[model samples]
Target: MCLLAMSNSLLQSAKKVILTEAQAVMMLADGLDQSFIDACQLIQNCTGKVVLIGMGKSGHIAGKIAATFASTGTPAFAVHPGEAGHGDLGMITQEDVVIAISYSGESDEIMTLIPIIKRLGILIIGMTKNVNSSIGRISNVHLDVSVEKEACPHNLAPTSSTTVALVMGDTLAISLLINKGFSVDDFARSHPSGTLGRRLLTLVSTIMKIGDDIPIVSADTKLLDALLIMSQKTLGMVLITNNNNILKGIFTDGDLRRVLETYPNIQSLTISKVMTPNCQSISKDRPAMAAVQMMDEFNLNSLPVVDDNNQVVGAINTHTLMQAKII
Candidate 1:
């Protein structure tokens, strides 16, 4: 075949797969009912985590679903059905809820473990394409993830079915997340090193440049001296303050540029003469994200941090926020 023809075939195949999977997800959404609500309530009422079990491709989907549940305020983890025969069933108990995943709802290994879970008096939630299959018959709640066809051209692979299963799992997890009122801070706690955690949990004092690195100068300091300090600190701005360390105004590189353009003798100017008064400042205890918002609102790159007395204690800029991953 020619290159153009082969490329056309590949593109068409990809588009068909996407369209099939999209249909599958829509069907899964439409099929949600009181059973889904009951499943969510069962998982929510469990004192322990949701122990998911499956075989083969369903096992892969089950693992991902377990991870989604765990990250979204619903505690869950996946266990292999075959492994349950090898004594992994001990991981589950009456306080936990078991979520069994199987397209046909008749995976032999899963069926074998169903009795064991039932013996423990554990509630079982079945996710499958067949509502009349063995797992569905025994489960306390049955969620239908059925799809009309597979995305695979041969209709033999677990393609559209898996997509539907994942979406259904997401629906359950997110519903529980909303019911529990999970906040950004709670999510951030689970991922302290991620950008969201840095934005939501990082405090201004943690990232603000402190000590002598802060660009500070007296209001009476000459423009040449202030410029030297700003350059030495490499902050592109200087805090113009009185001898008592109380902030009088702020003089940035932009302020210096304007002064240089407006005045004939830049060297003769004092920082107070060209500084911007009543500049926006934040307290040390505020979240670093708040500073990002201020900078965005005022089109500023730096902000002075002050104590209760309005004394400049530290300074932060866009670069600092970036370093902290707060932007």
Candidate 2:
């Protein structure tokens, strides 16, 4: 009975904390106004990077906000207010915009660098509870991230306030992302090691099988010979081309099944008689993701990679895409 009561009490406390933080986020959303717009425009117009600064708990949130901004097409980085006072202040330039995060609006370390930042004529965007606070009063634009109360029972820890500030930072970064018309391809270029990067940046030429690796048979080849080549290639399909390597058609396992059922004497038939003529092919220069889409839309297991003159240069299949993780 004692343990049960303690568990219930802990659950109630956890529930209260989540509800309080959620309400704080809703309040932040409802309070959005022109200050948000002004700050976004200021950062967008900046020719140099965005410099984020804060102290203590706000400093941690500032680093996360900086990372979010940098990944989402905005050039941004965080500078510890304490470190900035030492020498990191030199990183900021006249063309850069500084976003200062301090829930109380008066961090001594952050305040110390305000004079130097102002001297360089760099714009300052302040996020705080009150517009009239020290940091707010000196800021070119002030974003109010005030919350009704912290989720902490004593209202001492930086719980709700920090959540609100991080949300505000995300809102700003995403708004800039859309306003600048940043694309998935552009985002992929910045993150080459991520999954999206591999899908978008990987060209079909890099993944497609070339030369003997591609299962190819001349149009005059018998259906039995084509099946042998497909079995050896293990790509589930074979490409049919002319003597000059000009693509003519494609023969897949599915086509083989249908041909077996339709023709009683399949051994005597040429590959051209049962193969899919004028098959949908892709250029090797296209992104591998495009090949995935094309194969999915056409219900194709493999595709012939053609050159400018419709000559077979390579071949790609669902298996290759899966190997490359482009699927």
Top candidate, metric TM-score: 1
Model 1 clash pairs are: none
Per-prediction TM-score: 0.91, 0.88
lDDT of every model, 2 decimals: 0.90, 0.93
lDDT of each residue in 31-146, candidate 1, tens digit only:
78999999989989999999988899989999999998998888899999888899888888789999999999999999988877898899999998888999999989999988
Error of 1 at 282 (Å): 3.1
Off by over 4 Å in 2: 1-19, 194-196, 260-265, 297-299, 325-327
| Model 1 residue 17 CA deviation in Å | 0.9
Q: Candidate 1, TM-score vs. the true structure? A: 0.91
Model 1, which residues run further than 4 Å from truth?
A: 193-201, 324-327
The sequence of per-residue lDDT tens digits that candidate 2 reaches over residues 232-260 is 99989989888889989898999888987
Worst 10 residues of 2 by lDDT: 188-197
| Overall local distance difference test of candidate 1 | 0.90
